[model samples]
Target: MGLWTVAAMTAGAVGAVALVPVALGAVGFTSAGIAAGSWAASMMSSAAAANGGGVAAGSLVAVLQSAGAAGISTATTAGLASAGAGVGAVAGRLIK
Candidate 1:
């Protein structure tokens, strides 16, 4: 694999890790939190795509939902979505 491949994977992993709280079934985040995350992730995905980046929409949404439902912060939601989108895009580019 190329360096980009590795880097992209790392980013994806980081984003996924951020949402780890959901796996445990309770993290104090509410439904609004998840919705916010999903919205942010959608925007992030669009932004990435507009900039000529492409990450699987399903994956992006899934990650954001998982993260949000797990109690992810509103303040950090945008940042996480952006980061995850970027990483997923990078990974898609490299792997493709």
Candidate 2:
């Protein structure tokens, strides 16, 4: 794809990802202004057992930490995509 096209796609993807929280909140699925990172990190630990099964504290912590890390990683990926798109556009222009 052309560099400008890639840039446009990257921007659109980032925008879509950024809207996730807003959409979730609008649907009453998530609390307003609460970061997804915090939610992911605490959700497992805060959840009550559905089947009367208790989760081990240590395991719960590990799961929550991993989920939080994943959420952060997703944001990082979007940022990197945006940066790369800018770089690609510059390089493409210079090559012409």
Q: How high is each candidate's TM-score? A: 0.31, 0.33
Give the per-residue lDDT digits (tens) of candidate 2, residues 37-87.
Answer: 555324433553532454455564444344333443665557656765665
Clashing pairs in 2: none
Best model per lDDT: 1
Q: Once superposed on the true structure, which residue ranges of model 1 sit more than 4 Å away at CA?
A: 1-18, 23-70
lDDT of 2: 0.50
lDDT of each: 0.57, 0.50
Mind giving the per-residue lDDT tens digits that candidate 1 earns over 1-96?
566666676677576656645542343233454333444545656756765785455665445555555566675656666677677767668576
- Model 1 clash pairs are none
